[model samples]
Target: MRTSSGAGELLVELHRDNGVPLHQQLESAIRTRIRAGLLRPETVMPSTRALAQDLGLSRGVIVEAYQQLVAEGYLISRGGGYTLVADIAVVSPTAAAKPGAGPPRIDFRYSRPDVSQFPRAAWLRSVRRVLNETPNRSLAYLDGRGTIELRTALSDYLNRVRGTAARPENMMICNGFAQGSRLILQVLAAQGHTRLAVEDPSDNDLREVAAAAGLETVGIPVLNSGIDVDALERSGADVVLVTAAHQFPTGAVTSADTRAALVAWAGQGNRLVIEDDYDAEYRYDREPVGAMQGLAPDRVAYAGTASKTLAPGLRLGWLILPSWLVEPMSQAKLMDDRGSPVLDQLAFADFVAHGEFDRHLRRMRPRYRELRDTLVERLAARVPELEPVGVSAGLHVLTWLPADLSEEALREAALARGLGVYGLKPYWVSGDGPAGLVFGYGSLSRQEVVEGIDLLAEVVAALRS
Candidate 1:
């Protein structure tokens, strides 16, 4: 319960005589103070220089202590010479921080799914069946690479549904994409590969996770034509992470020609390709698009999760590894964690084997299609100038707002109206392009969509005038 995150009003003395490093000891002492409820969350910490001067220690020592806490999600740095205790105070602490309050409205945030139709009965039935049939080996710590049932089912599911040509041995289950990413990065770092390129307009906070492992993000502009291949060539990244099925924030599918070109480029340069097959199953217009990982499994690393498909609460996902990288990835995965929960894995496998999985997907498809169409239509009518991103094969729509209305003003205006929307500016590290909103319709109702967007439209109109 002791967390080293607080700004003390009293001049605390440091004990440098302990066997533990002075800074680490100091960090632990502060953490104890925090858990005891003596220090408050969001309390500002003294500058590293000031703390160092007071303790008669080097500034690097205090800075290192602060950085370690920050990496562990205990403290937050607001820059401009300020560090503060992280948000929320709790009696007990663990790695899993409690989730934010009950669901959100107009929650255009990503990684969402239609929870109303999450196949509750089907899942419970599967769990019951698994409990009945699971043997002694199933209960023990078997292969971290997942059970044969889920892998075989996934092999068929991916090939038949998601256009993934994977064999049973090629797939392994993990907690989710976040773990999968770290595993892949660990392998790449082990191979001395560091500089990597990703979509310019990409997720903001994750870049730091890569950076911590000594990987630098080389940005590539995301055009309506998928990634700008020319820009990618110019950037000269050692590896590339792309969302080919339906690109996040832009929803642009990697065109077939571009897919071939990317494969060829990777083969020629022997570079790694990280394919995030996110939200590939929720397309509305037509059948789901083919996964890029199938084009050259040897070069492409495929990652998918049940977060969007089932629900974010289900921390279950699978990665299909190529023949060459499979062993290394498995080793890295083992190093990270022994494996996912056997109970959930067995239950999911049972669900897939019984055809309940496919039935659930079929049932949810129409509802998602209707919701996607509703959101797109409402966006068009309310904000005529804003264009929704193409190839609707995902959970959310990325609508481009006109340059006349700045994202900064519009976000402020929308929040004032009790509506939530995030701007695309934070995603772009290369200083490229206009801002837009990533609108998620998964957890919202038809009425809420119309009303929230109407609020956004009003904000735009005000900014334009």
Candidate 2:
């Protein structure tokens, strides 16, 4: 409850003339802050005498307040008259149950990553190195294609890790995936490419992104084997954006044969494919699949980002274009923010070249896998009838709901119980399918995942009743 006076001290305001005792008022204030997470666990607090003097209260008042908090398990009396927040302070069940009522809800949205695992020290080292090593001229506005150092580093990393045949000249770094997709859509629309085909149960926001560029987006069916190549052909779209390595919301790996068929389809019609290699790192079932761009680099455009691996706020993403589209995409990027920031690009380059990026991913893979396993196990124990599909690779899994339960109803019921459950309907372009839920395990701890599922199971039971 109490924080150190030096820098970590909790600031509390008191009204002496109020009817409430000073000790009780102080105790309530500290308890509230502790539950709110403003005063984190294990934070050292000022000495009782020091605090009493600061608040213009008697030393006895501070001592009584501290004793009460200690008894309640909010603060602990350390040796030498020091008081600290308990490492595992017990928040009331009702307080912990509903997330929005107390702390922030444990969000299960699929687009997130556990940013708490981001390598701060490694990133700082890279940033420091970039500051020291980068030439002065490199800071100025340069080619819209991005810095040669970063493009080269990305080219090598993508080729080695994702099996993409990326060349520095073809790489264009833009602000995150949103901007990357926008730039590509703009270029395609300029080339008289009017129709775009996307996976049926893919990101709905993409339809708006395509519309901005005057291209119409049509939904192509997505099966267990990945996007239905036959359905894609029938759609007759000029360009297709696919998450081949691991499809979003479904985690369906595009099969080898289907990948070849897609390549052929693009070749025959002079169509273009954009390989959105999002969250390709955290695969657990087997060695992660390589990028589909390698199959036909000339027919496909490869896109990757630091959002999943690093943090989304960094606003960093890159696209490797084919020879025909490189200039156009580069020009499109030039018009969009005059290219991504150079400092971040350089730091990321350092992070990659020095092998810290690989090290960070190595550390995160097992943690994310453990979280995914915990979610599956808890849901199975509670709602055995609910089987989670696509538990293979990505941060999320899809589970088909019983015929009676609508995705919307289940989501609302779960939210009422303080669980942030998401439905697959919004992602569906046509909103066609059995009602299903998408559970994103990233951005949540293993404990939170289990607790959320337990609440979700209860919600489902109530819905069934």
Candidate 3:
């Protein structure tokens, strides 16, 4: 058996005379290894000097290759001249199946945040500070709810940002929004709540989660103003979930009149309002709407997650529960996983307390806005009939398509063109809604967004013909 080191054992067959530059050839070879899982994540690579010397190439060539890979997220520089592979999903050699028979080269799926812009240095600093500051006894079981430091920090952060009257005692941190929803539903079901009403065109997984928790899910219509309050009242559900700031798929902001109506409706029936404040931070136009929890704190159970703001891999979410629901939700959280990891909670507290989180958001907003603008502009030029629905906020936008192209047809056409376009159909509960496409500009670059939409326009033309 032979063991391989990245520097000496790694194989690269660079072609100098094959019309490809040495740097590009080296970059492609390394990328191929990563895609094929030949080089695993965190695998340390040889120094530029060593690799260049071994390959009989200038150090500048290896440096250029490494830089390109880093920008593409295939590699990461760990500072102090250390480089390692990034832990991204490994691409299959036949990932796109001859370009048109498999997954798209450009994924426009709406669930991801712009992870490339993640503040690694800031996060590392926070982690270091937490490690240095956290007492050993603090590492032991303190509270199933979460570390008080995090809850305290989150309480203040939410108050300032989302306008929620969050209190440390009333907050419970969970794995993510999904877990938070599950626990809330479990507690509600245990308390004799039977029905949960959700937006008609919302995440299907959310409906499934409610159903799994033994709550009957009722689908209510979502108009331009937001969830139809009249329809919601008519559903006769004991609990309702809403994405008030920016609705999923459609991006409708819950209007003041509708907000009042929903709160009134909740008051009338003593129903619970589970406000999913998922992506309220990235508002490109005007001031962001405040969380509905603030308007009716006693009635609303506010849920938020770092999945959208930071990265999904963080698996950090918090719920600002009403006084009555805190103990039960906290107990439920305890039984679920004892508690979320303490290290992350402590580090996040430091991150928020030191204002680094705010700084990161401020830095990312402009870049994301740039990507959004490029996506919208290119789509308007290429596909004039595609109307972008929803407010200019969040990482994704829903574009209502012309009647000629069905959502499924458009999605398939886009896929065939190596462009991943998600149909709005799956988001709908009743399976009957207008055709639309959801474009997520979170991960892709501005140039990539433009190229993808242009390809999508061509796909639509072909489908129309």
TM-score of each: 0.76, 0.78, 0.79
lDDT per residue (tens digit) for residues 1-465 in model 2 = 434654225588788788888899999998998886777788887787778777777899989999999998999897888788876644655674655464337667777898987899999999999999888999999888999999999999999999999999989888988998998898889888989999989988889999989999999989888899998888879899999988887878999988998899899866999989988987888777889888899999988988888889989999989999888887777777787889999999999999998999999889989998998999889987778988878788888887878888887877777678888888888877667888888899988998888888788789889
Task: Give the alpha-carbon lDDT of every model.
Answer: 0.79, 0.86, 0.89
Candidate 3: where is the Cα deviation over 4 Å? Answer: 1-102
lDDT of 1 at 421: 81
Error of 1 at 384 (Å): 1.2
314 Cα displacement, candidate 2 (Å): 1.0
Clashes of 2: 2
TM-score: model 1 vs. ground truth: 0.76
Off by over 4 Å in 1: 1-105
Task: Put down candidate 1 lDDT per residue, 250-282, tens digits, no spaces.
Answer: 888788888887888788665878888878877
| Candidate 2: 10-residue stretch with minimal lDDT | 1-10
- Better by lDDT, candidate 3 or 1: 3
